[model samples]
Target: MTSATRPQLEPRISSFRQNGMRTDALVLSEPGGKFKYKKITLRDNLLEPDECLVRIKATGICHTDLNFASKDRGQPENFPCVLGHEGAGTVIKVGSWVEDIAVGDEVIVTFTSCAQCRNCETGFPGYCDRWFKYNLGFSRFDGTQTIEDPKSKKPLKGHFFGQSSFAREIIVCETALVVIPAPTPAYELLAPLACGVMTGAGAMLNIVKPQPHQSVCVLGVGSVGLSAIMALKTLARPPRRIIALDILSSRLELAKKYGATHGINTTYQKDLMPTLMEITKGAGVDATIDCVGLPKVVEQIVHGTARRGRIVAVGVGLLTNAVSINTFEAVQAGLVYQGSLQGDSDPKRFLPWLLKMNQQGKFPYDELITTYHVEEVAEAIKDIKEGRTVKAVLLWDTH
Candidate 1:
């Protein structure tokens, strides 16, 4: 073909390694502080041989994000950090050694793990040996930051949960990227599937895996609880009854819309055990999932479980807090209490499965989303705390 007739090729986009870029991010300057909007210059060290740069499209505001932002969770190592884990975006740059994914691929950024660990090798990245260091350590596995403050000229912690995605762009490890189909829905609606939605639904489907016609009581009807309810509906023979307990009547009502057979407004009841027992006909529930990490709530739910019933603690709480349980009573009832992280999900397999279920209308997780521009992140967090939004997604105009 003649040169004139040959198609013109698009110029290759500049990458962080070649030409470092600056972008806007919501920064937390101190512990228990508000996220300040600022333009940050990404450090040249952002990319590693096994990393890739993602242009963030949408990021979910998870309760875990709020907890890290608002409380001194004893992880001072991660303070003054960029906090966000549930991110969905397009890959814009790949390091020299990155082969599994490349530029232009759509992906969900999730928790990172050492693939060689026993748990990860066995399909449980959530329980990776280096879970705390990789996800909550703020920096990369080697303790390095990818972003810096322009004025202070100091490193700002990044790589949170393998992708500090509260910004317009992020540097993430290759393992953290879960590629999704090209024709998927808007990124905003798919972001939560990376964390909150997956955690809740996976806890039920993967970890709990409740038997058919059994009774289940979900404590705290937030995104996680609602997700559990939605997953329950997909079972060939779902639980006999799905009870939702939350202080907010609106959340309880929303729970019903998903699949809850009963709603318990805990605020009106002095004790939750009585109401839960009554709902289970004095036998208590066959399974209880505590989405509220409070010790008191865990105690109540522990007491409300029937003989041989299982209780899964799905909530995150203060590090110093501990739940007091009567060992004798638990043993007598053959009650099982376990803690689940990220719903025991193997994101690669689970995420695609979830997307397929969502496409089939078996999982309507999008119904819980409330979108806001990136600048309105603070307002979105407030709405989440006030029980106004089930899931708040921050949309970035990366276009």
Candidate 2:
């Protein structure tokens, strides 16, 4: 119930291998609370026929992790759960049925999906039919928790997004694993590509697919927005102008460095729509991406898009918040507004492409990372919330 009560639930083993191969993890015992590092004993014979065990080298601290931990984006029942998804690691063990991946393979663990679903079969696993249940349900498909308290024998919800890599190790389904070649970039740098980076870059490259000479604007120039800017720069015929908007001047400057042609500090602007229109010369941008997901931000982007333009909402905001839109104006302008998840990426195909881009210095997403040891996760979260870091990755001492 409180941080003071954490000691009672302290793991009996100090090291993961001490008691049947349990591992260290930052567990949230209460809703809207701080993460307390504790050891957790995973289920015996943990590998399901379709699952594999991974020794996490690093994991990115995504806003979604913080949102779920803070009870801002998910149900409170998920409390006392291991919350993390952007993970990269080495396959330490594999299920008997895994054919494509083997032990010792380097992989990025992403959101899970039922391969047989209509959306997944159609190549859009981000919109998988069991998406909510698999990724956010805090349990396996058959309703089993992966870790439990040793003393009380109570289930501590695990499998958040199919692999709760906030721990030193995790058990993940084969479908959620994206194998990459060895001798690649450092795990800490590549960890974010599993989620935030993919979501931003994938949205622009895969969904928006901006035409040459078209104008585009990205709101909330954080990790996702900046990734969008970097990805846009690689276009064979890049957009005529790439606009970056944020309340922070520092992020706006980073946006410019990354490739944004114009930067707008929303803090200084009385009305974003007017400034956006002025920048696009009253024609409005061809594509406007709302990466902040605030209702007000969504409404403002709707007002700033040109006729036949597309407005992509990538940010995850409160479910109860609603944005008001003028139906007549939207119909008259022929504007299209849609939402994207994980950039609508098929990670198996997209991660490798992104890795190649990064290797060529075209993506340069590594420049955005600021690393922290697993124990310093709280500090990393603070830096992110205060806009001091574009991306924070937690490096694990799994060796």
Candidate 3:
């Protein structure tokens, strides 16, 4: 066959070298369902000269990933999409247009931003004007794909969250990359910091800004809420009382360890608003942050905030879900209820700031981890859904 007529490779069917041996990952058709793990292959997209390719060392499974696959949440991306937003990897190739990021640099992929928008320029890229297409739109901000199916050569979606990182290799914008210190266990720690930890901790430390002697209640004790608890401890005049509410007993214990002064078992409490009121002596909490966004839970919070208090809802709820609030109470109580994105954080600055906190044993965010091998991803998801683990991480390094 002439060169002009040569067949192109499929999106998820490209060759790679593991210890100098050629290998390939199969890109199967979408099965259309929930986020269940199945064995899949990683493909090399033979990136353009101006693009950079990364060898993913680890990619943490996030609730966002699960939501994308959920029918209720309505992930716009069709089936066969490679889903992973929290990824850390080493740069393996650099395009001609790329300069700052070079081969062998360790980095994390964060929220995609225009970097030109007012919000992005102000260091809040979570609200970037073009984020829908830049991140969730399932292509580069410019609408393009890096990989193609090996056989059919059809374009495959790349750059989910600026890096479709579930596979072994990912292509990303030089600007989206955040370089970390070399040999810094980029696998386990970098992913959570990308979104979950940042959202939880940032909401408390950056958005809510709890004052001394105030009462704060965190409504969910998962990874996000746990991070919030830890962040609270670092603040001057941390909440005099930090209440963590969850149905699980073990998570509540972990909450106390992280800085929560009290843990409420909703299974026994039955009525959350009353319990919250009782805990705060009927004054209501100074701040109530809901890391879980079920309608019922949000409703309880609408009723739980003290007069002039703040309610920071950090969790990602279903797009269809809505909560009704009493306008009279909202006005009479002077409540400041607001939704937070990326905990109102600037990843370029916040990621490093958090690393320092972890190194000093001040964050203890690592304690929330339950590690697993990359191949055992399904089990990790199962553990998280079953409440057997708070957060599950896939470890790429045996060490």
Candidate 4:
């Protein structure tokens, strides 16, 4: 039946929920394809009791988003995807089961998780058992698609991190929401906090927890590494030294603004251990974070830290790359090697805290962000890939 002849959708939200509204999206028709702005359908399904309609005000480009949009790992779920996870917007409609949140509320959209998982129940949704299925599944957790291509009417993937907010508007899982309080923060500024900022800050505040006299080294001066520096520096009694290392001299200099006491341009520095030892006064770094995830960088950081120091890995490299840890050296040195996801954060608690800190001027992040119109997503992606922009935030033209 034609939409002109069908019964009128009841509520304003139903018009979008039932009949599949035409909306703006940066669509990737196939894995490794270029993202082009096009019209897409919002899908013709009723919103579940736990869902809500959101108009994306701002969304940040993440490495994960780009990686998935540009690669095909031979997964059946690959291709025809919309990929933006760090989303911030205003709620336009609510589901029957949702009570705490309401229309007109400003919100930050984050990843989804099954409430039944042990991790979820214990406040670590980042490690949820269904995390991959619900967040990275492209489709809904049940393998259903909420978005369709207008012409082909073929199902295109949405719900990347439960929001697929590369589009102008989206319907998201209630579990993925974190409401912003009155005196609301800027949506564009808060967007990256949904993931990258949270991941980096959480690693320091939650995992690293560097001591006042200890030394912390960050092996990448991207958004994540900078956030880690800012976070540890914001501590009441911060570590004695925070080292920032990156191939780009620009990024290494930018890290100094955040809190890094020493900046190392890895491209020019042939050996890091000598510099690390000199900076630590021969004690070596007490903690090291590998945000680059390259084998060489990881190995260098692993060997540069002092005995019994913590070595944390947060970067995502090639799927085929195996992180070969030298078991004997690790055991002999009493070093700890660990992998962290989303900075081991529970978004419900962590995001809000980050916001409060931001408001207090202790965790300033504006310096790292660069904004663009949603239509200029291509430019934003390119700038981030080339290291010209630390964080690319896309602003939707809602009108």
- For 147-210, candidate 2 gives per-residue lDDT tens digits of 8767666778889899998998888888899999978678987799999999999999998899
Which of 1 and 3 is ahead in TM-score? 1
Q: Write the per-residue lDDT of candidate 1 for residues 295-344, one digit (tens) a residue.
A: 88778878888899999889967767788889999889998988999999
> Model 4, range 36-57, lDDT digits (tens) per residue?
9999988635566678888899
TM-score of every prediction relative to native: 0.93, 0.93, 0.87, 0.92
Clashes of each: 0, 0, 14, 0
- Lowest-scoring 10 consecutive residues by lDDT in candidate 3? 17-26
Clashes of 1: 0
Model 4: weakest 10-residue lDDT segment is 8-17
**Root mean square deviation (Cα) for candidate 2:** 7.3
Residue pairs with backbone atoms closer than 3 Å in model 1 (clashes): none
Which has the better lDDT: candidate 1, or candidate 3? 1
Scored by lDDT, model 2 comes in at 0.85
Sequence-dependent TM-score of model 4? 0.92
lDDT of every predicted structure (CA atoms): 0.85, 0.85, 0.74, 0.83
